[model samples]
Target chain A: MSPVLRAFLIISALLLLAPLLFPSVYYYRIGVLVLINTLSVTGMVVLLGYVGLVSLGHAGFFAIGAYATAVLPAYGIPPILTILVGAIGAALVAAFIGKPILRLKGHYLAIATLGFGMLVWMVLSKEAWLTGGPDGMVVESIDVKAPFELLGIKIKTAIAWYWICAVAVVIGIVLATNLANSPAGRAMRAVHESDVAAASLGIDVARTKLTAFIISAVYASVAGSLLALFNRYVTPDTADFLHSIEIMTMTVLGGASSVYGALIGALILTSLPQMLTVFAEYENMMFGAIMILTMVLMRQGLAPAIAQLFSRGRK
Target chain B: MSEFVQFCFSGLTVGAIYASVALGFTLIYNASGVINFSQGEFVVIGGMTTAVLIASGVPIWLAAPIAIIAAVIAGMTLYKLAIEPARGAPLVTLIIITIGASIFLRGLMQTVFDKQIHRYEGFSGEQSIAIFGAALLPQSIWILGGSLVVFVLLVWFLSRTKAGNAIRATSSDILAAKLAGINTNSTMMLAFALSAATGALAGVLATPVTFTSYDAGVLMALKGFAAMMLGGVGSPAGALIGGILIGLIEAFTAGYISSDYKDAAAFLVIFLVLFFMPGGLFGMVRVERV
Candidate 1:
């Protein structure tokens, strides 16, 4: 079997079997969050890792997906269709802004994306009429268990959401892996190394980057949609600057260049807060320390650093 | 007309603060191409320290200088502990490191001080000075005057002093500066310290008008960054111009347009300006060698 297929099967098996070790519904909820974050971070791997473009505003897309699900349903749109609508909306927004902002390099690009993210946040928070202001709004939950019930399996809501998110994550990983191995993916990597060189080599550098941006935006949108559906609530906080940073941190912390690294990053960040509830006030401090230490000690991130260690041991 | 004057006063007051913050960014960026995201935290530290000290019965004059000293220490500590250790890392890594430092400092502040919003009495009393039908607060004058004094001092330091010349030399070319026997590392540390001091001074002056809290740094950092970008990165004059422009624009927007969208105006202006002039108003157009 191909490496992609093998990796998929392994991940699928783990997702299926991991639930057996879950102690309660709370763990399942956290599992769902991890998978959602993993899905989003996979997109980060493609954009930041593959194309070497950083976006400090992807939470804007996430918020779009979430708000679409929350508000569109009230307008008689089907809940499931909102996900598709949200993805399309996010894609269009990314494309529209990406053209002008992508021309900026480095700090400029970071700030431009940040500006866009803040604009989205402002609109969501200030337009209380549409988004229910900062208080947020309730999301109409989708019946994920309906099909399973038809099959005579009565799974709990959390378990059903967990399975659904796991399936989404698997699909997301497969697609990302496929992209990573494709000709276009090669172009992205080439751009990541040197956009000038890529351009000289006849690659449409701008087009390639926009493609990555759009794809990543779609992934974030879908992940946001899933989170909204699972939680049955949506807030403007979903698209805040801190949320964007959290997602970026997860992507970089786990090793932005690898899918498995994305998974590791999502798992650790998602669960660390829960474990640190005992020292609640110290949580941010610990997080900041971890980020600094990680970058200073292992700039390649945890996964690549660990991989190197193991390979060196073998040598 | 009076309303306009009032807006202008408020605009200039806030603009002075933003200018100080932007100057901090310019200093560090020039010395070491790292955009210090924790610049606003220096402001917070300055203000918070002053508030805490004053509350503990320290005189205002004593509290203010102590706060500035604390911020300078924090700045040097950040460079030595976080930034220096990550030397030669990628730009993205440096950015994250600074952001991490900001978060760490914010957490430290939250732990060390209470989360309540705090501010000391303005250097002058709370009386409003009436000018052309507008009520101008005495604190605004202090903020404006204080910022000007800091700016003058900074310019004199950069242009007239030996250490300032060393910083300029390092900024122009690190290798060349080192070849000429300048300590680039120490210059960088000095840049960080000066940047922190500028930000802290702004905080000390403006806290009386805007108030201060642990979370206030985030918005200040964002606005300061916007000002830096607006004026053009790495240019002190640009930072000053951009910050004043941003403050004026925000004040006018709040006065005429929806107050809720006042913050949005700065970003919208940035978008428009970047599209037309990527180099900013005073920034030199960059030419890539490659």
Candidate 2:
């Protein structure tokens, strides 16, 4: 009945029908990746789009999640429980550092996050004893097919992961939408408009920013844990600087403002590389060019730009 | 004590090179508000171009100038094509643009020069001289002297020359500079060229000691940025002082602690400094009026 509910239904239907249309395990895997990326970018919506804060270090949280699942299983923790724990770990880390880091504005914040991401990458690569030392370690496989078997429906592992990711995304959207409508979300938007102004209105600017940062970090961690479960392997590359940039690019490219925009950004960026295999070596160049052109052409990004075009067309 | 002196000497050598790059960063940041993340790429281009040219039978003397010229052209082109077009964009957008430009330059270099590390012979022979019971390479002296010369020259230019004054004016206030009939656009272009030349020279000087690669630019940029932040963002003297301190810290860290964590020292120092003194050592404190 409501637009939010209607949008959720449409997205769920699309996710459900995608497997039927593609009917390939490979496509399902890519879809799962898109879903995972979409989950993370949705977090970016709160941080970058809502609060107007940028973090170049989210891959650090993503790494923490993946590594927790990879390493915690050895410590006898169940894989499923580890995912939640990983998210919690990421949230704690974010909250701990967010106070000092959030104090920095603009490029200073960017560089600080850059330093954090690089530190994570270095630790993941250098601490070979724990993290398998750059070569990475295998993750314990998750059992998502148990529910499907209980329902008497036969689904391949890839398709099962795809469905799980889809359900997760739907839940993520509902949460994001709910948050967008809440007082905290309004405070976040107000912070985006002007932190000083928000402060003037009696909002605790520091707490609001930290809240956005921690939420976004938790989202990234969860998405990362899901990715580890889906692939059954985790590498240090999962938390590299470029991957951090890629996440940011997707957020900005898709329009950072809304949930749907996060999904679109993830889908396009995930699919574009596969489609443009010939330009594989020039990937960095393309990324750089896209970021520059996007900012110069339309700062609000693709989804918002397209929405404006449609509105203009109606006029 | 000898070991400590040795570490200090090594620190000063690397510090000098970092100072050169930081100076370039300060120049561009002062003239234009943009922190050109691609500054290190100019260094790589200079080193790689010189290496490839020498390998291709060009005399070393001729190759060096040619390499610098090439980087200058690249710098100017980056300004005109990428930065100039996106004037008045938000700080985040500008940061992304510069980062993108850095990525693009690295990719282009990888394609053109392959992924191999490169270095030419130092200006002098590969002889080590003893100073206070410490061994010093001639290349180290060159790197230190070269950076010092550049610093002195920059100070002179900024204080004495009309073009330098124009750049300073533009940096202080673009509108006021324009009203005073100074060409702000040309000043920006000059800033790009001068910074690029300085970066390229640092690369040329340090390559014999540190080596150069397509991917090295990112780390160098990060280190230079850290150095710049340590001294103060836009102050030339601050850049030199900060770079030396970082280099000394790195050398001491490597000497005393695990060399494996030596690189981490820079980031740790950055965090500590930013936490305690956000404006850096020599940076002016600005009061925000809202």
Candidate 3:
């Protein structure tokens, strides 16, 4: 099977199997979070992993998704439709803002995105009339629990959300995997390696980057929407610069270039705090230390390196 | 007019802090092209350590230098352990590493010193002085004085000292500087140490006003970065000047516009500057080399 097909199969297998092996339903709920983060970071892989662009502020997209759902209920849109609106809003804003800013590379791009993220954060925190302000806003829960009840087996809200998130993750992975294999992905690689070479190949370097950014924004938005619905609440932290950096960290720590890398990265990061709760207060320290070490030791990220080690062992 | 004077003092005080932080950022960027995002952590570490020490019965004067010394060590450790190993990695990797280092430092500090807001008595007492009809805290004067002293000392060292010339040479062209028998690695260590010390000094001075916490590093880093960019990358003078400009803008925006939008003004200025003048205010745009 092709890499894309292989990736899809692998994702499906894990999503379907993880629920069965869970010690309790809480693991699945946490797994749902990992899956959601996996979707977000996979989106970032298109920008940071493939194109070699670094955005310090993708939480803007996340917040947009969150707020779209939060704000749209007054308009009487169902929770389901609100997600689509959020994704589209994120994409449009990304494309519009990205058109001007994407031309700059390195630190300049990073700062621009940082500003954009901060701008969104400041707005969300200050605009009490619209956002419910810094107090945080609640969303109308997506009513997906009805389906499990009809099947005559009651599933925990976490489990149902986990399945929903898992499906979303699979779709995001499939889309990103296909994009990475297409000519466009090649063009992105070309740009990433050398913009001059990419331009020489008749690729619109600017446009390619903008496209990646928009798509990545969509992924983040969807993840944000899912997170808001999952928790039934949203805060400006959803789009804070630090949160943006954390997402990018997930993308890099998991292996920026691989779809499965995103999954592994998300899973490790999401589960790390819970696992390392023995030193609960020091969890962030551990998270930070692991991130730095990962960059220093395994630039390819944890998943790919482990895979490499195992594959070598098999050989 | 009184409001303007007060704003200027406030601007100058905050600007001095920004300048110090920005200068620290410039030093690391000058040594190794990586803009260590953890530069702000140096400030946090300094302020937090000082707070801890003072609370533990150390004099504010002694605790301040000790905090700075600790920051220096943290900077060198970050370089030797995390940064040097990742030399020649893509800029993105470098960025992530620094960011990770910063996050790690923040986490470590929180563990070491619990997450609590900290404040200390100002160096020159809590009295406000009348300057041009505006009542200003004496700490503001110390902030202004400290900033000037640091910048002047830095200039003198760079222009008049052998080590300073070695640093300048290395920054202008690393390979040529190496060919000239300069130990670039030691210079890098020196750069990190110096920047960390400056950051610590700023933290020591400003903690009275701003308070200190592990999370404070994020905004401090962003403001310092905006200052650095405004002053042009790799220029200490630019960092200082850019920092003051940013502070003044913040003060003015808070005075005239929504106080909540003060952060927004600094970012907006940075965006506009980078968009229009990529070389920054003092940085020369290098002819593109493909």
Candidate 4:
């Protein structure tokens, strides 16, 4: 079978067998967290892997999406509309900011994105009336739960959200995979390789980059929306600079070039903290050590580096 | 009106602290071409170590030097152990390595020092003297004057001293400097040590005014990085000028604008600077092929 078909076959099997792997409903909650992260990393693959532009502020978009869900329903908007609102809002902000920021390259670009993320964090922290300040605010349950019970046996709410998130992750993976193989993806890679070369080939360099930026923002927004719905509470810390770094760390850990690589990275990172919670106070120390070790030992990122070693041995 | 002056005075004082950190950042960047995000961790170490020693009843004079010396050794060890191994690593790798070092240091500080915040008596006591009817701490004057002195001294050292010339040569062209018989590796190590020392010194000086904790590194790093970027990352003069300007900006913004948005104002300035002055205020734009 072709690569795409093979991937689908694997995904279908995993989705079918997901319940068997879960010993209790809590694992499903963790599973949902992984899927949410996977969606965000898929967004990253489009930008860093394809377009060649790195953004430290994608968390700004993620924050906007999250805050929208927490703050909007209080304004009488329906809970489901929050995701769409968040995606549109994040995309618009990206386009506006990308206008001037996209001109810089390398460290300047990195710092500019960092500034944007900080600005978002400041707003989230300071706007106590809207965001409940650093203490965070409780969100109304997204109530997607109501529809699930009609299917007969009432599953745990975490399981229900896990399935919803898994479906969204599937859709996201398919879209990203398709986009990666499309002409746009090819153009993005060209720009990534050498913008001068891409321009020489008559690609609309700025426009292509902007499209990818906005598209990635959409992925992050969707992920953010799912996270808020699942947690039923949101806080300023969700979109803080450390969270932004955490997202980047996962992307780098899993491999920036592939969605599945991102997925694997997300899964490990999401689960690692929980597992390390058992060790208590050494949690942060272990995290710091693990992050450093991975970046140094697996500089090509975990998935691709492991794959390369495997292929080398096979040869 | 008095409150305004007091705010400005406080802002300038803290700004000098940030400038000291930014200067350290520029020193490392000039020599090694990595951002050295761990710069903040060094500062925290100085503050925490000295505070702990003082708490243990070590004489203030003896405690301060010990703190500086300890941080200097830690900085050098970081270079030898982590940075040296990744000599030819990509830029991103170097960046992440420094971040890792920072995170590791922060973790270590928490475990070793505990999570409690700390402060001690300022060198000249906690008394605030009236300046234009707004009180100014004597420690603030010490910090401000000290940073300016370091800046001027660094300029003289780089231009006039033999070792400084060697560092200049290395920063400008490492291979050429190496060919000219400068031990480029030693120069790089020295740069990290000096830079880390400056950071630690800043921490020691400012701790009484601002207090210190395990969590202070991130904010210090962010402000220092912003100052370095504003002053134009490899330029010493830019660091001084930019540091003062950012300090004033924060002061004015906090005074006039919402305190909550004071940080946002700095970031906004940085974003604008990146848009219009990508090379920075003092930096000349370099042409590199995409």
User: What is the CA-based DockQ of model 2?
Assistant: 0.69
Report lDDT (Cα) of residue A41, candidate 3: 94
Residue lDDT tens for model 4, A1-315: 755555566665776687798888888888888889988888988887777666767788888899898899999988889999999999999899887777665455556676788788788888898899888888778566767877765777888888888788878877887788888988998988787899999999888888998999889888988888878888877776666666777777888777767778888888877666653466455555655776667766777877788899999
lDDT of 1 at B1: 98
Q: What lDDT would each prediction earn against the true structure?
A: 0.88, 0.87, 0.87, 0.82
- Residue A59 lDDT in model 2? 94
Query: Which residue ranges in model 1 land beyond 4 Å of their true spot?
Result: A1-3, A309-315
Select the stronger candidate by TM-score from 2 and 4: 2
Q: How displaced is residue B77 in candidate 2, in Å?
A: 2.1
lDDT of 2 by residue, B139-204 (tens): 999989989999999988887999999989998889999999998998999999999999998988
Q: Report the lDDT of model 4 for residue A154.
A: 77
lDDT of 1 at A179: 92
Interface RMSD for all numbered candidates: 1.8, 1.3, 1.6, 2.7
After TM-score superposition, what is the CA distance of residue B227 in candidate 3 from its true location, in Å?
Answer: 1.1
Best by DockQ: 2
lDDT for B115 (candidate 1):
85
- Candidate closest to the true structure, highest lDDT: 1
How much does candidate 4 score in TM-score? 0.93
Query: Looking at every candidate separately, what fraction of the true A–B Cα contacts under 8 Å does it contain?
Result: 0.58, 0.59, 0.71, 0.41
* DockQ of candidate 1 relative to the true structure: 0.63
